[model samples]
Target: MNTFGMWRLARKYDKFPTPEEKPYSPFNRQEPQEVFDGTQVYSWAAGTAEFAHRGAVLLRPLPEDPAPGRWLGYKDTVRGPALDWHTDLGVIRLVHCGDSKAATDVASAITSNGNKDGVVTVCALYGDMGFHGPALVAADTAHPGIEYEASWGDVAALVGQVLPWWPDLLRLPSVIREWKPDAQAAVVEVPANDNEKILCRAAANDVFDVTSRVAATDMANSIRNNQVDHTSHEIEIFCKDGYSETPNQVVAGAVPDTSHHPLPCDGDREALKAGWHKLALHTHPDAVAALEVAVGREPNLLPFGAVTEIPVRPGTISDRWTQRLTMCDPTAAHAVLAQDDKAEAFFIGPLTDMPVLRTPGDDGKQVWRFYAPLSLPAGGPELASVVLHHTLWVITSDGHVHPAPCTPTEHLWWGDGWGDRASEAAAVVDQLLDDLGATVDLHEHWNAPKGLTALFNEEHKKGAELTRAALLHARMTPPRTR
Candidate 1:
């Protein structure tokens, strides 16, 4: 359908019949014109005001207090009456309906009306005014086919300044911002040969020509303002390809990238071996905080469960993968055993070369080399592969965080299968220990260690008392995957 000179934002009502049923038309609809005797079309100031953005005076009366009343077939509190402003070109009306369904039905009936020559009925669906589909349905009829469509916001953008009535209705709780006032305020006269007449004529013409470039320009501006930016505030970056005092860093935004930076425990061996920069000695709190936010937890420089004198609180370190790497390995006792007797001295050193480190990059740039626990062969697959992945984080002196790279692995892709295998292996170990209780209980004797001769004599008696042939026959087998 072509652009029309008249427009109306109306509500659907069940009492109202379609044109086929009742043959109704707003042009011929009659109302008591005696009420609008002394009331003037109120003009509100723009910029946070309801309408009148471009200093244009509103042609409609200010909405009165919404009270309990009935409109069409629905019973509810009502605002102002349905009001219409007529111009030489056409007329625009605001017909407040009882509910959203009534508003939609009224709009559909009007759009589907055969005699609606210079009329455009818009169904103002506010809830879904941001999307194109809903906007189209709101602007067009929901009958056999859609005639015109635009979201309520888009319609507001296209003619909000010129046709301020509907936008004003949108601010209220009612579906149809009604048009006609009470009987005392019904017979509203035309603008008395002033700028208001010129403005009303212009609004009528604009609403008529709404299917033109003017609407297009407004929609373009709205679309530009509604675009989404997916940039993250804090990200883990990586070292650049070449070296410099201020080496350039590459963003790892969801990309597959690896870091060659040295770990805190490995000293400079891994760095030298990988030909990357040495670990930086200091930590930047801001950078650490950013890394924590990106990784969802604070990075532990030392392995978990490592005995320390510093009175570390339990659950302070939540990274289970790093914890298991050190906790499950017997040789990792060095991390727990203190070498000095100082009050603050604890064996807090990293057991494996897996803890994250702050390493110096080219120029004054520092990179956080985060080593996640991949696999601890010494602790066996169950403990070693607890966290079979690593992430890299790089921080520069300028304090900007780069997005971290995500490198996918088989264990991460199919974790459930790996977890089941690990659980089965652990269960087997538990079963073996339970069956060989007395034989394996020798380690418990160390709490009160006797002399070597006494330990040997006790071991000899226990061994002789146990059935050697039966023990040799009993075997523990790990689960095998086909």
Candidate 2:
């Protein structure tokens, strides 16, 4: 029963259930539609299912020790413990009341039932099959008393043992999941194009802490009762769509106060009017200006400049190695397209900060120039390819562009093919940690602090992947010269 309830609640929100509980779920059943069909047997099968569905949002990870003096009574014939989850109040149970007479019947049935002693029940009373709202009746069967609360007459509660826990179940997280676009709304359209972009920080089923949920309920009640004129909180929203909080103002860039993106060129201006394309705007002001001009004119153009800050700082590279590395300083002014005849065919910059850009030659055909980052003593990996939308392009110091012969995942994990090379990867990262005076050796201490291990591992793995991809792109690709 505990396993079944886990499946039922987890199914409400699209979170994966544990491996052990997966097979027992109705989702795996041959006829799941029949099992989920809205019938009295289905909802009241274990009696806890209805309230479990009702208070599903209030579920939390089960504490090591549940509070003493409470038990959940399942429906007749159903067995085992309650769901392996808890609420702030205690374990959850359910009591069903169909009408005024059924409330007394439910109380009598619960008190008479030997298994229901000291059980914390959530009573769900419905006036009729059609009438959904039920009056709040908090009852404690062990004490053999019941209290009727008139304020929440439309609310539901458990029979004979419910009042204490019913309120906590109603305290759902007050996150706004949907907002219809309105001319007068504070925030307008969520800006997104064909390309996948993160629109909001909050997810649809984000869970809040108990305190926040209680505050949300209070705030919601206040607004519903006409206690406040406006919303309790003011939220600042950023969107690319030309809608503003104030009339006649269309603020742009990352924040509302930031200046607008540069005006698009003649060709790009028409493209903008046509519709939003798969483009990521550059963060640097000059890069944004250049991207605006190149938007519609250039084919397969990647936006120049840093889109986001690199997570890790650049490692110390020798003076001679710096010269060998192209655009080692991300702040260096690099052009996407050169009007003069004497510019390099391509610009390959730091994998962390800048993107590799290719330009068309005199033959009116595109050519790529690749530059690989210096190899360390470990010979860990080299820059090989640039992967975009599953298409891999090999980048090399050979001053040419070609299609990568392998997939990005295969390229990154190619070293793993020669037996277990994870220890080698760990050793490579340990040297990086050693540079910072840290005495950590990932190869030796398997149980090192997570943060310390992650600090070196994540950067090393990411850098290694980029290097491998770039190297593959540079070496294996066949140049298609016009």
Candidate 3:
């Protein structure tokens, strides 16, 4: 039967009559009355009820250590060993309230084997025995005592004994698997461009580290296989669009003859000769100035005034003074003008300080002349043009004017190619502008005779004002937002 039915049976038989029948309430009032002490019986019944309802129950020992103990009892016929029960309360009892047949069989086995001992039972005036279900059945080994019908309440008392070894059994194997490291390779994609070319070149030369070798090789192969074909195809498609192949080397065109003769030198002849030879080889547009310097005498070889007989300094050359005249008309006039011994020599002037002007005489008048500075400008005119965004004008003594060339506008397929062209143009423009600006300033201040001094000063003032205005305008303009 179920646990509830057993509980109902226990309740019915365990009750007593009310106050009207005995003139007192047995549970709530005092009276001279007879009573039966069934605390152990009730305890067993309560345990049985618990066991029958719950299949298993945890048994916590005194010290709370999860260890095995001695068997008290089990559901009679399950054929398993009787569970061991241990607790700080000395010894505890477990009553199994399992199936009735199983309980009876267990009782018979324990009784037949004569293993039952230290067991007890209780009896009362009863008809139903207040037991409605099978529970722990203890066999009488010492004596055949009154047979008590166990209830579901008795099974609960035996739960600890029924599963005492559960904790130990559960802790058997605690091995866990270890994690393995990931070993997958990573992939990288290379973009088609000049950078790819550079990378490939670096890889070919083994300039990159070993870790990067694989990536570099892949990029190189990709460039060789795909980019090569693609570049060729693009070149073919753009061929008809006026796309010209850039020349690897630019040829120097027929430049004007602006070479200078060295000045007459009063220094050691051998040293002067060697200096002139070296200067001539390195100098452009001023070979004449160098020649005159090697001669060790004033260039005014003409029988003129005291200026012609002026004694040259120990290491000074005559052309050094004469070359200053070149700036007056750098395009055509070839004449020595006044000289400034304190002139700050820069770029190409260490060998010869003065620049002579070569004039082209036309119609019995010097109209065109080319100015050659003994020293090149500190920062060349090419760089100045890039910074200033202004064209340089070269004026000759014979009234000839030449403007520095502009950069060519051409599309380049690669950034390196474009940068190369820009750098080259910038350098050329810087050189040209430096030379022109120096020449113009030198001619205005140091050339033109004293009679033209006022006119030259006025022109210089105007040029200075214009330069200031341009600079101010640049400073005031708002920067491009983009």
**TM-score of every prediction relative to native:** 0.20, 0.19, 0.15
Best-fitting candidate, measured by TM-score?
1
- What's model 2's overall lDDT? 0.28
Identify the runs in model 3 with alpha carbons over 4 angstroms from their true place: 1-354, 358-360, 372-465, 475-482
Alpha carbon deviation, residue 398, candidate 3 (Å) = 29
RMSD of 3: 42.5
| Candidates sorted on TM-score, descending | 1, 2, 3
| lDDT (10s digit) by residue, model 3, range 48-93 | 5343222112211123333433444332223332322343322223
Instruction: Write the number of the candidate with greater TM-score, choosing between 1 and 2.
Output: 1
Error of 3 at 251 (Å): 30
**TM-score head-to-head 2 vs 3, winner:** 2
- What RMSD value applies to candidate 1? 27.5
Q: Which of 1 and 3 is the better model by TM-score?
A: 1
